[model samples]
Structures are given as structure tokens and as C-alpha cells.
Target: MSRPNCEDFRHLFVNDTPLMDMRAPVEFTQGAFPTSHSRPLMTDDERAAVGTCYKNKGQDAAIDLGHKLVNGDVKAERVAQWKAFCEANPDGYLYCFRGGLRSQITQQWLKEAGIDYPFITGGYKALRRYLVDTIDEVAAKPMSIVAGNTGSGKTIMVNVLANGLDLEGAAHHRGSSFGRYVTPQRTQIAFESDLAVQMVKKLDRGIEHFVFEDEGKNIGCVTVPLSINRAMQEADIAVIDDPVDVRLARLLDDYVVKMQRDYVAHYGEEQGWILFAEYLEKGMFNIRKRLGLERYEVMLKSQQHAVKMMQSNGSLTEHDAWLAPLLEQYYDPMYTYQLSKKADRIVFRGDYHQVQDWLAAR
Candidate 1:
């Protein structure tokens, strides 16, 4: 039977085909095709058991055990559901680990049931490999750059243009001292894999307009791929500007000084007081230097303080007034000095609204 071409499979299996990833739920949770609807044919535990069998029992014996272990009633139930889904969607595709054992077995059952479902070529493994290899292709191409001072909303614009990968957003944390987030971060391998996947997806879309947030090689503790880092250099920078008060308000809302309640309740007495003092003076680097688990407790206090002030006061106005003077006299000058040397045009901006509107267009 004729099979779908690569582009067709991509279109159908991803955008068009009803996608079924047969990996266990645990594997699916780790990652799956963007469009895949997981109906784990086997649980993770079951898959592990089967894998152990294959490892120790050899092929024939393992295959025999696998068949036996998949009790007839359970197999029938899974196959029936799969058959129904495929029959319901004429252009459906199913995939499994390496397209070796699980996918082949599923395909055989589909055929035996007189269903015309297709499997991914080489299964999810091949599809992932295709994405992995294409990452180099994307990295080699030129990308447009977005550069600005911190809180420039460059990453937000990156998503608006939907071009370059939003590693910062994907990680669900900002890329700064204030960026320390409440969420659990990814493992290095997982982050890299996810980053590559996003890059490949953008390339596949044939997007010429590559937009990326200006960032150092590392965002917090996560390092961007070297390939992506090099790719960023080719892009032009778009500087975003916001009013001092507006920026301060944003800073306060987004970043809390009192990450802990003690930051205020204990006020100036806690270790975070030193961090707060350093923040009022130096900024992020100093806080990082003194950071430890206990310090984080005090940091929480800072967040609490920032939050209290923010809620009681408006985001950019009343709440940020206290910081406004410091920002204008200190941070603004430092930012201006850095921006002047960016080697890129202002391209757009005199005010916060203007910058916001322009960045919105990006």
C-alpha cells in the first residue's frame, strides 16, 4: 500500500491526521507530538516488564511472553478502541517507541481487524530524529534579533511573531534575578530536547521572520544551545522602551523582594535583608552570591513585601513610586549606557505605549 510522504505525514499526522501516540502515559507526559492524543497501549510498568523480558529472555521467548502477558480481553479492549478511533478518522496515524515492536504489533492487529490505519515511519523515534536533525538546519539560517533592557517584553514579542523559540517562556520563568520562578525547571537534556523541537517546528513552518529575546547564553541556570546562540547573532535587534515609572511598576509586579513573609514581618532583621540591601544597591548578581536555601526564605519575604506594596498600590504608579526615584537616578542611567552601545537602531520607541504598540506588531 502507498504511504504518506514526509510532508504529507507531517501535515496529516500533526495538523491533519488524528494522531495516536501509543507510548505509555508516563512517556507521553514527558513529551509527545504536539498534536498527539495518547492512548497508552501499555502502562509504563507493563512496558518495563516487557522490556525486561526482551532483555533477559531473548526475542522469541520475550515475544511469546509479551503475547501471553497481554491477556486476550485487555488486548481486545485496546485494539477495539484503537480500531474505532482509526475508523472514525480516515486519515489517522498511530505511533510507538521505535516502530520496532510496539508499532509493528499494533499495525498487525489493525490489519487483522481489516482497519487501514498507518503508523509513523519508524515510529515516534524517527519523527523525533527528523526534528533533531532539522534543528541544525534552523541554526544555520539567519535569525532576526530582539534586544532591549531587562523587562523589555522581548520574549513576549518573540511569541507574538511566533518565530524563534521562547526558551524563557517555555521554561515558564523569566530570564533574570526576578526571573527565579515558583515552577519546577527542566533537566538539561529535557530543556535541550524541547528547545530543539521548538526550533525545528519554526523552520518547518518556513518562517523567514525569526524573532528572539536578547539573552546571554544562559537563562537563569538553563543554558541555551550553542547552535541557537550562534543563530541569534544574525538577527537585528529591536529595542523596547517603557517609562521609568511604568518600568518600575512592572518590575515590582513581576518581581517580589520578599519571596518570604519574613522579608516584611521580620523586616530588615533577616538574611534576605542583606539581599534586599544588596538589591537596593547592586541588583541581581549580589543576591545570587549570597543565595542559599535559608536565604531563599528571606527572599520569599522580599516577594511578600513587593506583592503587598504592589496590591495596595497600582502597578506602575502608586506601588512603584518608591522605586521610581532609584530606577531613574540609578538603573535608568545604567540601562541607557548599555543600550547606547547595543550596535542596533532604536528602530522604535520614545514612550512605553509606543514601544508596547510597536512590540505588539512584532
Candidate 2:
């Protein structure tokens, strides 16, 4: 009845375990289990102190100091909070760095209180290992993919599925420079760990259907697994076509300023504003080249006042002008063409509800 093993992680996930992370506040903030609401047993400073103690003073001293820090009253407080959480989620699980002493201490406290729960064996390290191993295993098996051009909502649909990998979301980062809204770009290892977690979930659901945003080897900084990429290349694809205007609107709305906010806020008001002014007249045309004339014109008009304000103060760099057009007119289009050439071609095409139903029925 206890949620402990990797084989049961999906059950814990479905049951909505609190995912009590005992690692430390900092790591939790970076990235951890996607569905888990984390409550760190050790504060950032406390964990760091123990780590320093372990390295400098040796294991015995570290344990003594850790004991000194984690006194009975404080321990009781942790048990109380976790007890309350577990009361609500009887299936909740706890993990510490490497699933070691910290988690052991916490679990012992639970047992002393007569709470018989099994903690994740081997901790986050094991979970991380499971993620890597499982992703590789799943990749060797077949998977179906949904591929499309930029703004195809392919990434969005992946998350909506009853089960699947949301690579862009998994990374807590999107695949584009402009797509780092929900969380800052993750460390390379962290991104991969997160992705592997999703892969395991998808494969375990008895699901071979994979929906991937047609990404290059690198999405900003994170590199997706080659196996998953290979599967994507081989799977049947369907272009999630939206009108150029509609796609264009989504592109700007997702990236550019909102509520007519100064375009500079997209970067930063002061510095980004200055850049917009200095480069926009010349640069604006270049952007138009990629975003397309109509959409580009719309954003330019919207950003015009901000452009003027900055120009009155200073100038934006125009250095990217030459390459921007190349990326816009030639490279981007070519990339799409290659994706079309590579994929098995459209298998299904509809809006998400339609597509979701298609996936649901299957």
C-alpha cells in the first residue's frame, strides 16, 4: 500500500502524491517531479552546511552536526507537516538527495510516530537513473509522433494528452529563445532528467503515441534524447496547420509585449527599449521578413511608440539584421521543408479537442 518503487511512481502520480522533496529548497526551485508539490525537509542553507561539513569535517562530524541541527522538536515539526500532507494524500512519497540519510531520518521519524510508509528506495538519484534508463528503453520500442511548423500548438497538445511527453514543458523551458516564461532555462543535466521522467510516464501508460514539437537536436540549450528524436523522425506526422495570420498572431502574442506593454518589456524596459529604437526602422523590416509582412507590420505599428521613445533616447543594435533575414526567408523555410521530407506525412489534422479525441479514442 506504500508508494515507494519506480514501478509504482505512476500510481503515486495518478493518486497525486505531495512529492515531498527532502533535497533542499534550491534544487526544488530548479526542477523536480513535475506533479509533486514540494516541501523541502532541509532548507537550502542547512543542506549546504551539512554538505560542507561532510566534505570538510568527514562523515561522522557531518552526521553529528546534522543530528544537532535536526533536533527532536524540529523533527516533530517536519513530521507534523508531512503527517498532515500524508493524511490528505495517503500515497505521498518522500525523497532526499540520492535517497539517503536525509530521507532515512525523516522516514524513521514517521515510523517512530507509527506511520508505516515506504520511502522511495535509493531516492532522487534512483529516480534520475530510472528516468535515463527508461527513456532509452522506451526509445527502442516504437512511438508515434505529431510534427508541425512553429506555432503549430504541437507542444501544447502534448501536455493535454491523458498521457505523453511534453518535452518543452518537461524542461520547464520551451524550445525557443523567446519561450522561457514558466521557468528559466534548466541546467543541461536537469533538463535531461526531467525529460526522461516524462518518457517513462508515456511508455508506462502502454502508450506508443508520441506528440513532439518538431525540434532540432537542441531546443535553446537542452538536447532531447536521440532515441526519441529517431522515433520522431520515423513516426507518422500531421501538420497542425493554422492560418498564417492566426499562427502569426499566436507567435507575437506568445512572445511580444501584452496589453500594449512596451515591446522593451519583452526583454527589459530600459535596455531592451534602447535596442528597439536604434534597430527597429531597419530591423523592423527584417523581422517583417520572417514574421511575414502583414503580421510584422502589425507588431511594428504596435511597438512604434516604444520604438520612437527609445530612438529619442538612443538606438538598438542592427547587427542581427543580415542573419535575421536569412533565418526568416531561407533557413527557417528550409528547415520546415526538411521536416516535411523526413516525416511519414500527415496522419491526422484537427484542432486540439479534435486531436485529443482522436488520441483518447485510440
Candidate 3:
């Protein structure tokens, strides 16, 4: 039976289709789709050698060299891995960087191994291009920015909305100094891929207008695609006008209680506490210059004292000593200035429920 090439990239992404990436490890590391599992046809060193041969010699010579390099037990081992992945993900398709020689060779080898599998036409490049285009396409759709002061539960609101896009969640960072999770942030390419997939999935559900949290271009290390960011800047804004007391309680739950619980769950009690303390201290120290020397020192002392109190007595109340001021002095003023710039775009300003209802009605 002849093997067919898969070309429905949208279908693949929307359904979370499994993909077998047959690119070299180095290429895979730089960027790849979220559903793509790396099962390289050649090792980095082998690919490098083959590439050098192709540059100096020709395509035929390069192909011969690749075969020689990946032959025998080496070839058998790779084929075994591919076979196992196919067995595990029977519906999955495989692909190389360009859906060229590497993927074809892998597909042929799989045939010889008694398993016939399809490969993605145009491969990783085509899939990536499709996603990139998706971002640009969706950017043209109507969108609203959910803007608010820090700790106003903007993320919570975004998550609750039917058409909302969680950009920070895609970046795996919370869009603040204190936003780092125990897990590392996604690579820039991975972040974009995730965001594009999200937009695609939402669009498929017939969402006409998207709702997004107001954010600067960069979230952690990942930058939002320029088109989307530009659209967000011009989009109508719904501000969450929760008072300081409300925001403070929310911040404590998020930055302190829930964050500490997350660390503890990931690393266990002793090590988790050490890292959690470091996370908070480092977050504060990251903005020391802006906080000014005296103010930074004061907050640092309060934060340290708060950490010790929690460590000693298991009490969380002391955190408000620094957190309250951190909000009033740092985040709130910064938010006020930022919101002022976008003042003309603000369409509605209200507490959480009001904003929620406004967005829902839209």
C-alpha cells in the first residue's frame, strides 16, 4: 500500500494530533510544535556531517553518507523508537524539517519494519507557517482587553470567559516579578505555537470576538506576536476596578498562599520552603532599583521577617506587611500610569462581577 502525506495542518492542531518530528535534535531544540515529539532520524553530529557533505559534495553523496551513518544497530534503534511511537500513537503522523529526504527515508524504513505510517507534507515548516498565519488572521478579529490593577484577578476573568485568550498561561509566567512558577517558562517558539493553537481551537468553536488580559508585548521571555499585540492596544478595554482591600486579599491568595502551596507540591516541604523564600526575595530584589535603596531595604526586611514568621509559626498574616505596601506604592501607581495611557480605549470600569457581566454581554 502506498503511504499518503498528511496536509490538513489545521485539523491536526485543532484535534491535538500527535506528530513525530524527524528533524535533528539541534533543529528540534530551537523550535517545534507542541504536539510534535522529537524522534530524530539523525543525531546532531551525524546531521552536521551529512550537511557538510551536502555542501561540499551533492545531494546523492549526502544521502549516501546519511544512510551509512545511521545504518545497522544505530538504524535499528531509531527504527525501533519510531515503531514504538507509532504503536503508542497510531493516529499520529511523522515529518522532517521540510518533509524532504529525512522524513521520506524514515517513512520507507518504517515500511520495511512492517508498519506503514503517513508523514506530514511540508512538515514542520508548513505546520509552523500555518500557525504563524493563524496568529495574523485571528489578530484581525474583534478583541477586548481586560485591564486592571495588579492582583485584580484579570487572569481569573480571562480564564472564565468563553472567548478569552490566556497569553500569560501560554508563556507559563504570570506577567509579574512574582509570577514565576516552579516550572520553567516555555521557549519563545513554543509560546507562540501554544498561543496560535489556542486561537485556532477557540475560533473553531465559533468565537467571533476574543477577550484578552491587557499586557505589554513581552510576557516573561516570550513576546506576543506583533499583530496580536497591536490589536490588543487598540481593542476596547474593560477595567476591573476592585478596591485595594479586595486586590490585597486576592494577591495574598495568589502570590503567597497558592504560590507557596505550588512550590511545596512540586519540591516537597523543606526544599520547597527554601525555594519559595528565594522566589519571593529574588522577585523583590529584581525591582530593587525601581523600589529605591531605602524602600527596597525596608521591604526586604519586611519580606524576610514575614518569611521567618511563616516558617516559625505557620502564620501567613505577616506577609501583608510587605504585600500591602508593595501594592499601594509599586504596582498600583504603575498600573495607574499604564491605564492612563489607555484611558481613551476604556469602555467599562467596574468591580469583578460587573466587568464579567459586561464582557459576557459583549
Q: Which candidate comes out best when scored by lDDT?
A: 3
Better candidate number, 2 or 3, judged by TM-score: 3
Report RMSD for candidate 1.
Answer: 7.5
Per-residue lDDT tens digits for candidate 2, residues 55-166, read 9989999988888887788877877877776677776677876777877887887788878655787777776676677777777765556665555567777777655567
Off by over 4 Å in 2: 1-7, 52-58, 72-80, 112-116, 157-164, 186-201, 234-236, 240-242, 256-334, 337-362
Against the true structure, what is each candidate's TM-score? Answer: 0.68, 0.67, 0.95
Over the stretch 1-362, how does candidate 1's per-residue lDDT look in tens digits?
46466335345533545678889888877766555688767878787887898899888877787788776998999888888888777777888877677888888888988986777777777777665665567777756566655555566567766565687865555766556543456645456555665665665677655566777688767787787787775456666666454566566655543333334454444554454444433343344344544644444455446545544552323334334443554456666786677666446554534544555465
TM-score of 1: 0.68
Q: Write the per-residue lDDT of candidate 3 for residues 282-348, one digit (tens) a residue.
A: 9999999988989999999999999899988989889999999899999989989989998999999
Give the Cα lDDT of each candidate. 0.63, 0.63, 0.92
Worst 10 residues of 1 by lDDT: 314-323
Index of the highest-TM-score prediction: 3
